[model samples]
Target: MDAMIPLAQFLWLAGALLAAGLATGILAGLFGIGGGAIIVPVLFEVFAAVGVAPELRMHLAVGTSLAIIIPTALRSYAAHRARSAVRADALRRWALPVVLGVVAGTALASVSPDRVLKFAFVAFAALMSGRLLFGRDHWTLGEQLPGRALMSAYGFGVGLSSPLIGISGGGIASVIMTLYRVPIHQAIATSAGLGVLIAIPGALGYVLGGWPHMAELPPLSLGYVSVPGAVLVGSVATLAAPLGARLAHAFTKRQLEVAFGLYLLIVGARFAWQLVA
Candidate 1:
């Protein structure tokens, strides 16, 4: 009983989480993401408001974000796959390497400082933004996806980087596929599947990695992952995801690219400011 939060505060946080979930679901669908980018930032604010310690805040946000992403990623991927947009062959190829990469990333999280994670997030976000905003159709690594060795390498990179940024590997995977001449829609759909791969393992990793810091976290927490956050956010996210997938099909490729690029740019800048400030 002593550990329970005030009912009023809990309600307020619930409202916020639900609102963020709706937005996150929409973006996840539209961008083929697991909504972790949006989730991490929103959870950071929520945790801070509730007095989660500074050192543990980012880890909690990231861990909770991954947990919330599971359902959203599944929903988005299902919606995309139903539309016949997913590149199943590529997904099959990347699956094993991606899982391995996530394992490595999770291990890294156990020893890395929070600042390092934030920096990685900022750097990759900026890279994704720049590629979307400034890259031309002519710019590509090749006209087709490379052989197994290179594809595995790419999958590994996506897995490794996603945990640091609290994403489900959608942004990185989408960008890679597009570079190899996959249609934007196809790439996005395929990337949505990557979220499923990244989130499951990433969430578990965060839980284990943050176990030692449990005393510094809020109540109802599973290590760094917030059970409440996941439940509250995941509920609305799943419902809203289909709508976003529908809307994504309505937009042109350039429009989607521009919108996603702007979104990432803004997010990246905010995190960058946090680092400097």
Candidate 2:
């Protein structure tokens, strides 16, 4: 299409997109954290360069990020499943509530102001980073709560947050599980499985919500999800995810968490700067 010619001319931009995806994919697989921490920021920069409106920029970035995550998570999940690391029971218990929350969150996103959503996302990132960095020692999942309630609460929070922030929901879920004494590896594996569930509905919701606004976007887009961007990013990410999973075995659990925590802090600061600027 005529609209795509300009984008095609910018080969360097395309390379940047792919490289960002590759880095994020490795991080996602290694830490069991969704690539959202990396994806969102990169997307924001890319979209801005392409002249996307400020109001829709973050939403589109988040939506497109979720779109790519669907495939990446599925690929990672498959690999983790093969290793017998996925906690199916936990996934089943939390599925319903999480799905419900995803729908609710996505619907809310469709109508909410962009500024509100961005602020909320920043708050979430800060909270999650704090929990990972300082609260790790005090958290524990007691046997006292019913499985359904625990799953629902955790799933709902993840679902609600994913659409709003364009994250894969793995980081928060893993952190929660770790606090409750779940082995770090199992939590990471299980989070990958749950990420698929979060991404599916959330991605769908974004598409539907952004459909009316599609004509406003640049070429190679489906609503707020940029098809080209997703394709380029998702492809390499899928291949790299398994390698990350394999590397996960090399580090002690504490070291992995600390590394991930530092990553979060860095990412959080970047987003905070974006918000302020």
Which candidate ranks first by lDDT, i.e. highest?
A: 1
Model 1's alpha-carbon lDDT is 0.83
Residue range with the least summed lDDT across 10 consecutive positions in model 1: 1-10
Q: What's the distance in Å from true for residue 183, model 2?
A: 2.3
Q: Write the per-residue lDDT of candidate 2 for residues 1-277, one digit (tens) a residue.
A: 9767666744655776687677767887898665677677677777788677888888888888899889778988999999999778888877888888889989998888777667767777678667756764656767332467766887898889888998878888887777667787888899898888888888888889889888777566778888777887778777777888889999988778778778767766766777788
lDDT (Cα atoms) of all candidates against the true structure? 0.83, 0.79
State how far residue 153 of model 1 sits from its true place (Å): 1.0
Q: Which residue runs does candidate 1 get wrong by more than 4 Å?
A: 1-12, 23-34, 79-85, 239-256
TM-score of 2: 0.83
Best by TM-score: 1
